[model samples]
Target: MRKTPARTRSTSRSRAAVVAVAIAAIGGTTLVGSPASAAPSGDTTQFKGVNWADPRDNYADDPVVLSGLSTSDTYAQTYAKASRVISAFRANLGANTVRLPINPYTVNGPYWKSYRGVIDAATAHGFKVIVSYWEGTGARKDGFIDDPATYWPMWNTVVKAYKGNSRVYFEPMNEPHGYTDTEWADLAVKWLGTYPSVPRNRVFVSGAGYNDHVTSVCADPRLKGTYLSLHHYGFWKEYATYDQWVSDLKERIGNCASRTVADEFGAPMTTGLDYNKATPDNNSINFIQADTDTFRQLKMGSVYWPGLRTDDTYSLQKLIGNAARPWLATTNQSGADRLAWSWGRGKPVSP
Candidate 1:
């Protein structure tokens, strides 16, 4: 998710504090600092992950087929390209998980038939895939869910398609910006009820306010089995010190580390910054280090944003000339190094 105005982040933080205080005043346990349920093996806080985008971009909602994959091709044929990319992820970054953004409208339409191939290919390659909804223009224009009529059905189709696949995870919505903490929790519960057959562990419930803050979501007992989805970008607070960033990140997790995943976090790949250096010269590097350190200390997993994208600055991989699949790009050596170091050389754990 793109960074919003500074005021928005400040406001969200303020609101989170207020809600936290209210919960405390009522003699309710905040669940803050509580021990989190253990994550899947190999899926510890150090599990390396990346976000792979469709070649068409525009949030993966475009009606046209992506370059490597053909519209008329069989599932096997379309998945060949994905397999190549997944291989690169393993060989180059030691990444085990990939978070994919799905256009809500495309699921039940022509897109669904072909998209299933991508998910199947990722799982076949031993990678955990997270599929989340992104409302085309709504995502950029308002970041809110404006229509349940279309939204609910899209998810219904998603659950039915991958409910039985353990490697495939369900993220109800990408960033529920319009809903209050309680409202998002309500919707998550509703979604859980809607697909009773899908285990709670397979669902990723996003934190409130652009999936930035999870204190409220963690406090909800009904969301127990589900992992918390969090998105943090260095640009969100361009000037924060490493110490401040670390503190803020921990605050955001709110004691739900074990069951939390930083599914979306990134920095500028073109900056040529050294992640190991703890200086103030590069906030992106600092952000990467802070998050890596925080997740490591807390034993939470993370997926870097944009493992591949057409012209994104934070993409870990860039498409080779005319090649549909992506290869590791050299531009973000520091970011790549940090991810590899965090992930280590061990086999990736299935989420």
Candidate 2:
């Protein structure tokens, strides 16, 4: 995940300052249009989730990272550490789901022996897990997997492993940025057919362009019976207003509200900031609030980008303490509050 600078402080200290000035200029609500509204589904179940990333595995290039990185003692210790992290997610953020980033090479190979433990623990703790493939130790760490020869077989191994497990989900690929809309749609259709045993509803078809847009994928008639996965970040559109941000998101999502899920979206949480209009320009807080509002109102599920990516500021929660019994701390209070709010912890925000 890439990092972005914090929102710039405006000349006016309070949001009301901008509000009054803008209102006087516009004669009414300064923020003009509503987002391209999705027809809301009566199903109000919100998917409050976070990406529980591995601190070490994301950087590994070897197919069998577990054996390469850890000895017997260390392997057991790492498994124990993951349990604490999952517990923290449940205890603090009330995350009902976790988007697990996987190195296709490692997971499909020897690493699966150890990785399955984490998936099982999350399942036992009652968190829906979406496992996604990332480029590991290859030609380019560009977040695009172009080698179908190696890619197809790796996913075949992954889908086959969890074909019977309803709790564990199979995301064909993380973000298919290499392919165009039609190409990616074709691949998604092929994936469903390849693994007929794995139910289509359990599969997550990623949006085109780094999982940033879903309109094309949602429009595809062939890619049905699957949920859409989207990844949006404050860094994507710096200095965008809340309305502009939401409008852009709505445009990408198009009409697939009920079937779409924001599997990845987040911003810097280490900086001390509240998710409000006070820090308007380029603020992650504003991003969270606007996106959270959309997710809740449209009844679409949202999973935060990273729950525990070691050095990543986007991580909602970080691991502290020893490897034996790791402790998790909330990186950003206001950011976390918005997540809880999206999950229905407080009063609902009207659309």
Candidate 3:
């Protein structure tokens, strides 16, 4: 599903206060630390993951509170709740990685301490975490960094906290549809230069144009070592055959499968779509089948758009049991089967 336009809310803060918090949070680490050793080539397939998103689809002017998490909770409380949710993701979906959304409001505000719980719980459980920056809502949600002043400081705080952790990866931005391809590449170059301490392999450079394609970013020599993130949805096409979908996706990827991961691709899971059987007339079914088949054939890693979201029809898993200690139930077994197949497990379906 396509992202809904972000709703507006004010997030003004004292610049000096934000900086002070960042320095204290970093514990004296330099804003730009010395460059780390070169990163070895990575295997994208190791990232069998799902996105744990806010009920608002991770687009919020305020702090992004993920499903099953509450901002009112203390750090320890958030950690405990997150542990249960992360465990549910693994048990229900076989996920080993989780992609999370972060914004200045969450990282540079009072919520930072508590938000760390989500990251900590995921990593403690041996799940790789992809922390991506999401832009603000309403007028500020124009596919651009709302403010670089806050943006740089936000990254400083996050990089300081997780730079040492190998399982925690950083994605500079979600989907930069505002800039031209060349401009986006340049910005990514700047991000790499600013944080030489982050291993290249641990960074995910989003594909340009609402993250609809990766070939442009992949072709840039400056972005060579970082993994590229791609977002594809069935809504992008009104209707297409299985082979047509395959061709469309490949054209966006070009020769970059080795360094590409479809981190945001999903379809209607709760709609009772039978992805296991051929459904040429059903766009959602065709899209899911084609994308999963292509991913498996290419040996590429893919994270579903959302493993859990409150009200999205495309959510692969739904909350169940006690709210305090939440667990998940798969909304559609066939969708789960398709996800498993994409991850190199489960039986393949005929096209």
Candidate 4:
């Protein structure tokens, strides 16, 4: 979910704001795991990642062209450009994973053949790729799949293309606030049934309702082996103490921190907020500090929102150099410090 005047995305609460499955056997094939015997909670810390979104916040009626790549580029051209940008992410942020957005328009169109370069380049660099679906703009942005006819075929194409690649991970929907909890769970179960060959560990089932909470999805027995993706943003609240923010996050997670990955969480990076300091009166500062502290304490994985998005104040990295061969520079060192702190590196801040 993303909340900005430029783009209208999903919200966790009415106030505003931002922004996985299992396995089983069938038809004589022996499944690897069972729901009765819980799979060990994965090491979420392994995913040190950031989102690389389209300039339009990934809500487009047409193909979504990422910040540095164009729709007209060939596969080889995209791969070459993505290689430089991906390397810049690692050089500037020590990142090893990237979360990217996909929509029916992008996947079911001609640009898909070219877009494969982004995923291919990331995996070639040994980076984990999390491919997620985003809905269209205008009336189509109602927190639901725009059209099932296009939706299933999109997933079919995506799953068939990437299921065999160990470095690629799939997230069914970005934020399913349109459906009730039960409805969403049923949908997830259906996804799992459709793609049994993809390991549950590689699937990221979103939290119900704007991806604000994961307790319901974590409690679902059928989704045992999967990872859970969560999105939290400072704009969700007007103000909060560090401890209050910590408690708020913990309540949403319950005891499922091990299986949870805060794939999207951020404050305004270009605004000069000092996340390293203890600013009790500042909402963004307090939210960033508390969330990073909680994530570090729980050893949960986190991916900063918009590692590189054009003109987004919350984008941690900014594009530099030519459009064909782009690179990134950190927007705020203090904000970068908080991200590193959440990832279990960098100097610790005193509470």
Please identify model 2 stretches exceeding 4 Å from their true place.
Answer: 1-46, 56-60, 63-78, 137-139, 142-146, 347-351
Superior candidate under lDDT, 1 versus 3: 3
TM-score of predicted structure 3 = 0.90
Count of clashing pairs, candidate 1:
1
Model 4 lDDT per residue over 43-112, tens place:
6888899999888778789988888889999999999999999999999999999999999889999999
Instruction: Report the C-alpha lDDT of model 3 over 140-199, residue by residue, as the tens digit.
Output: 666667777888899999999999999999999988776667666777777888898788
Q: Candidate 4 lDDT (Cα, whole model)? A: 0.84
Write down the TM-score for model 2. Answer: 0.81
Better of 3 and 4 by TM-score: 4
Pairs of colliding residues, candidate 4 = 1-19, 20-204, 20-205, 20-206
Candidate 1 vs candidate 2: the TM-score winner is: 1
Give the count of colliding residue pairs in each prediction.
Answer: 1, 1, 0, 4
Q: Please, what is the TM-score per model?
A: 0.82, 0.81, 0.90, 0.91
Off by over 4 Å in 4: 5-42
Candidate lDDT (C-alpha), each: 0.69, 0.67, 0.84, 0.84
Per-residue CA lDDT of model 1 for 246-303, tens digit only, reads: 9989989877877788888888776466675666766776778778777766777889
Task: Estimate the lDDT of model 1.
Answer: 0.69
